[model samples]
Structure formats: C-alpha cells, structure tokens
Target: MTLAARAPVPGRFRRPRALRSERRTLHSWLMLPVEAVARLMTITWNPVDAFFEAVFWRDAKRPGKPFHGGWNSMAGRLARAVVPRTRNGAHVVMQVTGHHLRLAYVSSARTLTGAPGAVELGWYTDLRDVTWIRDRSDVVGGNHEIGFVDGSWCSVHFVGDGWSRMPDAFPLRLSHLDAIPTAR
Candidate 1:
C-alpha cells in the first residue's frame, strides 16, 4: 500500500486502563497522610457549644445566677482559637474568629499579691459574624467596658458568680487550646 493512501486505526490511541490505574495509586498515597492530619486537627463545634451552654446559659438542671455589671450567668458559646506569646514575650497574631476582637491578656507578670499569674473569664456571644464579649467580673473595669447594655453597644459584666471570680492570673491564655501534632 502507498504511504499517502494508508488508513488510520480507530482504537490505537485509546488508553483508558492506564488512566484508572494511575489515578488509584495517586489517591492511595495522598489519602494516608491526609487522614492522619485530619484526625489530629479535627475541631468539633459541639464541645465548645456544650461547654458554654452548661457554664453560661445554665440549662434547666442548672439555674442561672445574677452578677454585678450585667448578665449573672453564661448564655451562649462559640468557637475560638488562641495564639499565645512565645517565651521571649513576643505577641503572636492569633486568628480570632470575630472582628478586631482579638485581644490578649498576659498573665506571667506579677499582680498586687506578688503572684506571677492572671486569670480572665468572660461571656461572649457570636451573632452571625460579629462577636460580643462581656466580662464575668469587675476585675477589668473601665479600660475593658464599653457602656451600659441599652440600645448603645457595650459588654456585660457579672457581679458574684464563681466564674465571675477569675483569678488575677492564668497559666494559659484560653482554656480550650489544644496542640495538634505535625508529621515529620
């Protein structure tokens, strides 16, 4: 047969079998590492929600109490990620979920009693994308308060609840902070 008149074969270019095998191998290797990391970094909104509900809102089994400046008990809860300062006292930027509400409370400094710690307790509400925070006690007064909780914006302060009485120092910045291991 002359080269110019030769017919082309229809099935010669197809390779469907090789594509599936390559895809399967790639998926198997990627999945192993993905699974381990997923388990380590998994954060459930349920634990955070339940803790806030039990402490602030005070469900039926637990009655709410009254405090000084505003709300007497916890009413709601939301998720928060805290980034602590390094050993050299350098403040790290934390990815707080709310607006510019990413405030820090360092406790390593000594207080009036000559102690080397501080405690911070507050009630916060997450509405859509905005977050409202209210101190549980008067430990932090003027500098932290906004105004009265009327039509104007302000954070509530509690008077006498146990949570309202946070120590002047705390070891960790946030109670819910946990470390997820990284793979080598």
Candidate 2:
C-alpha cells in the first residue's frame, strides 16, 4: 500500500505493522546495550541540561521566541553547545495537538533570513527527526509518528540526551506556521 493509504495500528503511538515489527525485533536485540548507553548519556547530560535550564534557559517553559540572532544570545549559545544542531536553519514550524506536537522546518523562507527562494529541504516527522520538545516543568521522551506533506511517514524515537534550551523555542519557531490537521 502507498504511504498515505496505510492506517496506523491502534495504540497511543501508532506505526505501520511492518515497521513496528522490525523495530520490535531490533529493540529486543539491542535493548540491553541501548539501554545502557541511553542511561549513561542521560546520567551525564541531564545534570548539564538542568544547570543550563536553571541559568540560561529559564524561559524554557514559556513559548519559544523566534530565532533572531539566537546564536548571539546566551540561551542560543547554550542550545548550540548542548542540543544537537541541524544543518538546515532554525526556522521550525510547530503545531500543538491534544497530547502531541507536530513540528516542521521551513528550509526556505525569505521572511526568516532575508534569503531569496527555497532550498531543497528534508522533513522529519518522527521522534528521531526532533531533537527535543520541552513542555512546562518536564522534558518529554518517547516515540511518535511523523509524516511529511508529501505523504511519507515514519516512527521516530527521542534521543535520550536531547533537551531544549527555552520553553518557547519550539512555539517561536512555529509562530508563522500552521499544523496540518489529521483525521482521527
């Protein structure tokens, strides 16, 4: 079946049957090692994230501010130092659904950077595609379904060590964007 034609399996986080099965098997095999590494990374990074959040990222719970000279700001510098960087510029679009958030990157936008035209962009819809999502008081980590406008979809897991530098970093990136509504 084509991507859009496929239905999500019934669950909190739905995924394609074939992909789910493959992931299940792979997760089973790698559980121990993956867990070990994840635990180690979390142990090492969570404290740093907390410190940074306490100092530079105090506004992490507020809606994100747009990326204006973010790199020059202390929060932006901390975000760059700790959070993983994407090659595409930082103009992300965010949509908050019930219990879920959808994010997309504006790879080309003249308004964002005063650059002309569009660049070839890659979309990430899954957990792996996003580095972090900061909610009030807590940082979430889990797998979620991600789909692109082109009808491509995948399941992505959150990186164990990822954390956001500002509460509003995500919302700010999405200020000018709209979420694509999905049928229940």
Candidate 3:
C-alpha cells in the first residue's frame, strides 16, 4: 500500500496570533511607567545640570574630573546630583565620526570594576549601524543611540545642553556631514 503525502500544518511552531498580541500589549503597558520616569528625570534634572555646568564647570579643563572642586565639595555634590543613574554605570564619552563610532571612558578607583581608561571603536562600514539623534531642548538634554548589526545598541544621554561650545573647540559642520549617505 502506498502512503499519502501531507502538507505541513500552519502556526505549528509559532505562538498563536492572539497570544502574541496580548504579550505585546502587556509589554507596552509595563514600559509606559519606565518611559515616563525617564522623561521626568530629563525634564527636572537637565536644567539643574546645565546651570551648574555653565556657572561652575565653565573653565575646568580636566578630563577625569568634570566638577570644579573635589567630589566631597558642594559644587561636586550638586554636579553629581543631576547625573542620571544608567545601566553601564560609567561616565562615557561617545563620538560619531564619518567612518566610526567611538566610546571612551576614564575609570578611576570609584568605579565598580576598577578598570582604568578604556576605548571601544566600532566601524560603521563593518556593521549595519543605525543612529538616532535627539535634539537638545530647554527641559531635556540631547541624547543619541547607535544600533549595531549584531542586534546590540548603545545610548548616550547628555547632562546639559551640548550645543554650547568652548572657545578652543572647532565649529561643528553639520552641513557637510549631512550630505554623506549613511546607509549600509
């Protein structure tokens, strides 16, 4: 006797549509409070950080120490108060150039890992990278995110209005950078 061939059943290996939709809805509801808290922090703390940066840390040139005085001092306490607690737990410098995205941090004795200065560079051409840039505002400071091809992403949030430039720094040329195609 010959056996009859049968087609594979649909939705056998995947979750049901209704269940998937319900999970998505639950996830969105859970994330609403988190997003709200982040926005609240941005609105309240950004101005405070900006004021301290403009008045107290204006002339400071040190790389590791951003505050004018030591961490125990009043200026330092006020400065530190505005810094948002983040996932990485490190103060990082993020720069996006034409060819690469760079993340550098100065690690001191206070750091949890106790690692020293470290630098990480990822070339855009090597990965499918997407960047999200948020413009600075009076209440909220500017922030950026870089999504890599490996499904990993990094975000950087500024403590103050980053538009202000020091006299020695070169002028930002937005027009030239905008002309280049960023697609992978």
lDDT of each: 0.28, 0.32, 0.32
Error (Å) of candidate 2 at residue 104 is: 19
Worst 10 residues of 1 by lDDT: 1-10
- How would you encode candidate 1's per-residue C-alpha lDDT over 1-184 as one tens digit per residue? 0001111111322201111111223344566687688977765468988788768765454222221122222211111112222221211121234322333333433445775434332223332223223332333331112212232222223223342233222212222122211112
lDDT by residue (15-68, candidate 2, tens digit) is 111111112233345566876788788674578888887788666553433222
- On a 0 to 100 scale, what is the lDDT of residue 130 in model 2? 32
Instruction: After superposing candidate 2 on the true structure, give the runs of residues whose Cα lies further than 4 Å from its correct spot.
Output: 1-27, 45-52, 60-184
Model 2 lDDT-worst window of ten: 14-23
lDDT of 3 by residue, 56-103 (tens): 875573222111234333222222322322222234443445554333
Kindly indicate the candidate among 1 and 2 with the higher lDDT: 2
Of models 1 and 2, which has the larger TM-score? 2
Residue-pair clashes per candidate = 13, 8, 0
- What stretches of model 3 exceed 4 Å from their correct place? 1-89, 110-128, 136-139, 144-155, 160-184
What TM-score quantifies how close candidate 3 is to the native fold? 0.26
